[model samples]
Target chain A: MKTTELESYLAERRQLVQEALARNLPPPDTYPPVVHQAMHYSLFAGGKRLRPILVLAAGEAVGSQPEPLLPAACAVEFIHTYSLIHDDLPAMDNDDYRRGRPTCHKVYGEAIALLAGDALLTLAFEVLSRIPATIPPERILRATRELAASAGSQGLIGGQVVDMEAEGQPVTLEKVNYIHNHKTGSLIRACLRLGGILGGAGEEQLALLTRYGEALGLAFQITDDILDITGDFSQTGKQGGVDAARGKATYPACLGVEASRQKAGELCAEAGALARALGPAAEPLELLAGFVLRRQG
Target chain B: MKTTELESYLAERRQLVQEALARNLPPPDTYPPVVHQAMHYSLFAGGKRLRPILVLAAGEAVGSQPEPLLPAACAVEFIHTYSLIHDDLPAMDNDDYRRGRPTCHKVYGEAIALLAGDALLTLAFEVLSRIPATIPPERILRATRELAASAGSQGLIGGQVVDMEAEGQPVTLEKVNYIHNHKTGSLIRACLRLGGILGGAGEEQLALLTRYGEALGLAFQITDDILDITGDFSQTGKQGGVDAARGKATYPACLGVEASRQKAGELCAEAGALARALGPAAEPLELLAGFVLRRQG
Candidate 1:
């Protein structure tokens, strides 16, 4: 895909996510005023919406539309938001800034922030369940299963456990890989799995997507670490170099900046190759892999 | 129905919950040792497994099988367990004990505790999606919809948000009700609603279940408050009276013990009446409501 084609594809996903989340929830009028406002607050706060985009892109990869996957997509964003809030808790990471705004727990108070995370997660399931009835029940079940696995101990939770455990400790490459692979990699896998499941990706297609997911997941984390060190504060939204300060087990922390950069390049190429393995169907997914590595954010 | 019949019925539902949770999770062997154990520890801790039982009973009220609703029932339990872990966190309710054992975050550390909560919440969806392919897509979607609504900002999350805000305050009756209603009640309500949806409850049956849920929920809270003051520490297992000490709102605090007891009696009766409307199928639900009130733990 040309650079121009990739940009448009990315833009299409961005629009799809924004539009879906914008109206994805029921009308605010139905809820208690305060709770409704709080829900909108964290969800609407601007971010890349990477998870939802993954859902859409994955769905499109298998010749699916954005509509069937919207609820699950919105749900992915909810889980991501919930994690940010909990991570920001006074007892946890403790930094105040996030996504160019005060963190959810910071702005909402720790208790509210905690509840917000809980609410966001619940909202995610709610969204998944509300998918269009025309979609196969089996498909909906598959998507929810992928998402649930992504969210659970074997996936994100397992990853987070290792991540926090590694803080202030010397993180071995094994530990670092476990943290990134589980914490971030699992969900990336879920995104592709969701796309594949929703899109009807066959065994071969799924196998390719799985490889793409592995490569992209690592590349995504490596890029995040690089950005933490090199990106401007205004652009990254989250506080900078704080990972090193907190002694977080970031990729750059273990590999050093130059090595991390090389690793990220290698991972991106591997991801692109995996996407290419899907032939033309995965062009957008392949282009996405490059964008994940090269994007300024 | 006679009390013996009720006991038999309750026993059957309890058995159902055990099976439901059993089939849905990863084989403990497959899990990362610690992660797997923690998930099982919280999951199997010996309570009545009341939420799943309620779900099963609710399904029975409309002829739904116990097996089909297992995923959702387990999901409800997951949400419930997540709340308990967070409630026990140092930054929140801060109890060192639960069910006569060290609390999750206590044994696992706060970080793992948080992830455990996240993992449990995520698993709820996984369980929901794991339902067999034979079940209609519409039924699965509807079941999930009920799950999400009860779990989200409009429900449990909202109640928790308010509960956090209201702690250590001079709370009014209305405020206390809101906190209690949402914190525990929303989920309890969802348990039945999901069951109803799964069981094919008609609009009328659903409405009746809603009423049953509301009464049972309030009664459940009132009983929790009463237990905090009245139950023995050895019996309850969890550290009791923390609510009163924290000046957290409670029915007894608002209504005094006698009135609270009377109110629980009234609510349980109301729940029973709603179940009675279901004829024979409602008997288990009625007994379930009574079980909520009369049990010491």
Candidate 2:
């Protein structure tokens, strides 16, 4: 896919994901109006929407409409948004602002923000349970399980604990890999796997997509670490130069910029190869993998 | 049941529930030692363990051991604990201590406390998913549905949002009931309903238990409101007069002390009648219901 084609695909998928997210969310009056507002705050805070897009791209790679998978996709982003909100709490990163506005805990008060994060986390599962009629109940269960396992203790939470313990300390490559794989990578892999599973991809195709997603996830994180050093903070939204200030252990901290850059290229190549193995159906995913490697942020 | 027998039963159930909770919690060191330590700090923090004990009593009332119901009991409490941790954040309630120890956010820092809460919430489902032995998958799914629903928007989260919005204002009696019912009442009801469902009690049996639970839960909050006015701070583990200090709304605040006391008796009678309908099997539960109404905290 060419650059313009890729842009159009991403834009279309982003819109679909957003609409699905809005639709899947608990109706405003179903909850008090304030709860809905707080939930929509971080959710629609407007980042790259890369996570949900990955779900669509991977689903398309396996001959799915992406609509059936929309619940899981939105759910993955909800988890992502929650982690971001909690991560920015004064007790956590102590950041006053995020995405150019006040962070959830900052604006809502620590209590409501905490409740908001809890609300969103549970809401993710609630959203997943609302998968459309076309999707099989078995497939919904499969997708939900993938999400739960990926985001739970053995995955993301475990990784986060490791990262916190390693802060301000020297981190090994093994430790960095462990943290990234769980903290960010597991959920990303879940996004693709959910798409593939719900899209009716066979086991072999699922395995291939899993490989593609894992590699793509690593490449994405490597790019993030690299961006933390060299990317424009104005564009990144997060104050980029703080990794060293907080003594956070990042890929760039563990391996210099040159090595981190090499690792990303290597991961991109691996992901690209897996996506290409799916033949014609995988072009959009191929473009996405490439985008992960080359993105400025 | 007399006071001696009731105390013995409550004590026995508390021990059983505590043992089950300790056993079900993920053994520490599955990740870095610190993560496990952080999680254990609050998980093991002492409280009345009322919720789980209630699950046992409700379960046993329907001729079930309540042992099979412990996971659901623990899950509800995990949700409760997660709410407390988040509620105590600097942006939230900002309390430094909980149950005489530093709050999770206070002891572990905001980031870890946030993650700890997240981890606990996630583990609740993980614990539920693993039944001790063969059980109907439908029951498991039903239990999960009860727990997930109770913990999120339709239940605790809804109450929390309203409470946050109404912190200083003189919230109306209707709104206060709405808040308490969702914030705390929903989970309490869930505990009994969960116990009934998990114990494989019949639908008729479950309905009675549900009524019993709803009445007891309302009375539980009313008792809490009463305690805030009259109980000794040392005995209650809260600073007496803090509720008025914060201008937080309570039943007594709106209904006046005499009416509040009468309401408690009314709720208690309703709960006991439900338990009495179960006859001899519900002896402990009948006693427990009346006891809940009289408690100062």
Model 2 residue runs over 4 Å out of place are: A1-8, A27-31, A56-65, A132-146, A196-206, A278-283, B1-8, B56-65, B132-139, B200-206, B278-283
Q: B68-151, model 2: which lDDT tens digit per residue?
A: 777777877777787788777776667777766778866777777778778778777667766555456556666776777788
Query: Where does candidate 1 stray beyond 4 Å?
Result: A25-39, A168-170, A279-281, B26-31, B238-241
True contacts kept of 2: 0.39
CA lDDT of each prediction against the hidden true structure: 0.80, 0.80
Residues B167-224 of candidate 1: C-alpha lDDT, one tens digit per residue: 8889799998888888788888888888888778899999999889989988998898
Worst 10 residues of 1 chain A by lDDT: A26-35
Candidate 1: which docking quality band? medium
Q: Could you tell me how far off, in angstroms, the CA of residue A114 lies in candidate 1 after the best superposition?
A: 1.4
Q: Report i-RMS for every model.
A: 1.9, 2.6
How big is the positional error of residue A20 in model 1, measured in Å on the Cα after superposition? 2.0
Each prediction's TM-score versus the true structure? 0.92, 0.90
